[model samples]
Target chain A: MAAIPRLTSRLRIAVTAPATVWLRGAAQSHTWNRLSGGGDRPRHLDLATLARLRLIPLVGFVVAALAVPVTASATTIYAASSLSKVVPSIAPGNTYSFAGSDTLAFQIENGAPADVFLSAAPLYAERLHSKGLCSTPVVFALNTLTFVTPASNPAGITRVQQLDRPGGYRLAVGGKHVPLGIYTRTLLGKLGLGRALTKNTVSSYQKASDVTSVIALGSADAGVVYTTDWYANTTKLLAIPVPASAQPLIRYEACVVMRPGSDTTAANAVIARLSSLAGRQALFNAHFGLPPKT
Target chain B: MTFRTGLFLGGLVVTLVLTFLFLLTPIAALLLQVPPRDLPGLLRDTAVSSALIVSLKTNLIANVLFLSIGTPAAYLIALGRFRGRPVLLTLIELPLVLPPAVAGIALLTAFGAFGLFGSTLAGLGIVLPFTQAAVVVAVTFVAAPFYLRAAISAFAALDRTQLDAARDLGASEAMVFRRIALPLAADALRAGWAMAFARGIGEFGATLLFAGSVARLTETLPLAVYAQLDVNLDSAVAVGLLLLAISGGVLLVAKLPPLWSSAAPSSTAGGW
Candidate 1:
């Protein structure tokens, strides 16, 4: 207990070193098995098996290491989609990941360890805050909701009012609980196209990226996704911004998730950098609207 | 023992120990997490019941499809002399090692509404993606290989002399196969079907991606478990336990003797 800090680092070192060696051995044995089919040794194995074996350990290491409660020197910040870019730009040395806002919260709820959570909505962070799982939430970035269609325009959808037109149009949207889904539903109702547009729905997938995939693949006629999602796929998908009057402001919030005896100084520092002037510029450059004035 | 044999035995020991730890521990613990008091309520849980209903129906169809198409393919591989047989076997087994996510996307690319063959299916007014049919397709794609591989092995293991003897006794090839080969391989085929059925029922990633997880629409047991994981873990555990129970039943059914007498012609199913 007294040598806790030292013990944890040593444990990490031990786990990774042997795990890598065993993984390599596993790869060799796999190749040997394939190559020496029906023998004491394998004769040949292709590059594909080698790649798969390499990825298994690497992914296992990441997930295992994160799941370990022992916090090392680095801070693990789980940011939501649009904020993924901030890690490389603002804090290159930290362990950063961008999970869907709902997924990150759910993971944390189920005991995923993270020092900081940068979420797409304050609702989740506030929930965690109320439960004492995280610090008070701070609003950071704002995103606008929009709809998109494949560039091929298979449905010939040209306007917001056209969204409701009867053309056997299939629509894709996020889960009902997620921020994007709530916003998309509100926008549809406000435009009086709620029943018409949502009725021919194929599926309400997990999150924003799923909605993007459905539309991008031309599986659905249109998808309601975040404006940033449209910007990211400018070539593939045509962005149709929601009418400003009906547009709901999506506020992305950040909070430091609690960890016993873990040094949160670095996590706080990372959050501070995100709200900094440079971070603001970086966010805008990446098409995120600045956090609204208090 | 020679040094090399000693090394091999030592490696095997380690392998068995590690495999047991990695595989059994999680399953044992997960099942144990289902409270004893919660056992009776598993059937009463709406989500669990609905998901299980979907799983049983889709998997039954998928396995029937497998037994129809895949059984013959397995028999051909096992008995037929053919060129490029290794290539054919490898092709059949390719999906066995595919990551479920990759399999899901692969199914989508080939069968989605705008997929390569999707437009053709659509022209006939059939939309597979996000439908119950898509779930069956995904299960068939992933589970058929399990059945085929096992069935092939089962067929291949038969004594060829018996086949030849029956043929020499003035039995037609079909007669020889029906009387001699079918009963001999019946147990193996049942085992294979059970494995494939279990795989189909346990499918998650591919089904979620290809069929979409709409509650009571395409949401099978695995999807229901996922949806309920963080929200209502008890219900999730109930569904998982149900799957385990079904899997156990499948194994037991496969292991038991045929319900009818083995000597009867009724026991012989399908062409040799």
Candidate 2:
């Protein structure tokens, strides 16, 4: 019974005793400061006063935002998220500001500036071209999907059909807007395993690059990713060939987005270079696979 | 009115009205777009209900985990001579200012398969990413800071006189905290919890990066919103409405603190 009071005292002191301690410490510091003629100031802002004062600047910012029109002067290149890694290498030291496909379209739709649009699928380029957002779409390279698993192969997945076998193992794929997701669905449908397979899917990321990372990270048992991604990361592991019969040939397409003071000649030079031997070499080097025989 | 006064009023009106519109228009548009006939059907859909259940469960777990650790840490900092306070606070609040994508990447680096302890975890047969558990962890990482920041300020603002009085009366420190300090700070802590809960419910970027948004599995409402936007608009609208309502409700509760429960010095005279 005596021990209980002691325990409670310790607990309470541990929690609430600090307030008094801090206050005493602060008071002592002030006394010492006065005795030594040292001056100090409070650091924290009075938040209530700040709230009222900040409104002035907030209004000013609104006025300024309306008055000033900001635009990038450099030639803008809109690329898919997957290019985040490979684009730097593709156009080493190229003078261009990159944007994501969604933001690019939104900006271009709202009359922002751009020079080139590289889409994961030809559909986006064609859509933009139809709306006069860009030039005609040109297919650049083909990508095939592959299934990647950790070296340990924890899911005991030896065959593609075993994926739908209802265990707790998580399967990762690309999101619906992603090219990989569409292809994965199409291929699964062809194999008559679409809905069943989806039931087991635990993650659908925005890009094939993200899927590769998830799989590589070992959070996912298996992932559907681009051939190039497999090549880039699968140095030790061979891609479980996603049977050619079931594979949907993925394409990367590009078109020059129209801009104010748009340089058709310079833009075409870049486009021509992408199809050029050096560009094709870069694409092949990345293992994006050559464009299928037209 | 004078010319300067009129101009000031006009600017103030513009600022306040524009700010309100900027914040509300998008959410209001979503709320208005909820087709009356489809509202029931959308809510009934497995995708909607499942995602809602998953979001609530995961966010609750995140909130609980945060408070469990955050409250004690706040207590330690608020009392006595706090050492390394700024460094400790910065570490705790890193996720607050971090972009969701960076937060996700950071989580991946620490907990993902190829992460810092990835191999060891793998050897131990433990993988966290792309799981429901991973979603809770991500939300907790992003949401805990809200509660911590609020609690810190609340504890800082507490009156030392009352605490000293309680101690002078021969009350144990535990009794003083239980009867005085805890009640005094309850209102602020409640608001902090609401903020944390709201933030956790709406967490997307980091959760997506760290946990992977899979429908009917790991996907939360935000993920469901993206998924439905990819396939169907009605589903997205319904799920979006649910998120807006929950987020709004949390803010409402935080703002209207006195209505629900009394934080009126209830513990001052109570025997602990």
Candidate 1 lDDT, tens digit per residue, A1-294? 334334445444545455446544554464344534725544364323533334434545667887888635778888876566555687678777676787889888777778899888888899889989899899878888877888787778778677655546667777676777777888888888877544564466666777787777776777788887888888889876567888776888889888675447877888888788888888888788887645
Query: Model 2 chain A: which ten-residue window has the lowest total lDDT?
Result: A45-54
Model 2 lDDT tens row, B27-135: 7787678766788888788878899998999988888898888887787677757678889878778789999978988998898877898778879987777678889
lDDT of each: 0.76, 0.73
Instruction: Compute DockQ for each candidate against the true complex.
Output: 0.20, 0.31
Candidate 2 Cα outliers beyond 4 Å, as residue runs:
A1-66, A85-113, A129-135, A151-164, A188-201, A235-238, A258-269, A292-294, B1-14, B28-44, B113-127, B233-238, B270-272
For candidate 1, the TM-score is 0.78
lDDT of 2 by residue, A1-75 (tens): 344334444344443354334333443453334533545554342222333233333434457778897654554
Candidate 1 C-alpha lDDT tens digits along B159-244? 78877877776789778766777678888889889988888899988887788765566889887777665456677777788888
Interface RMSD of each: 7.7, 10.8
lDDT of 1 at A270: 80
Global lDDT for candidate 2?
Answer: 0.73
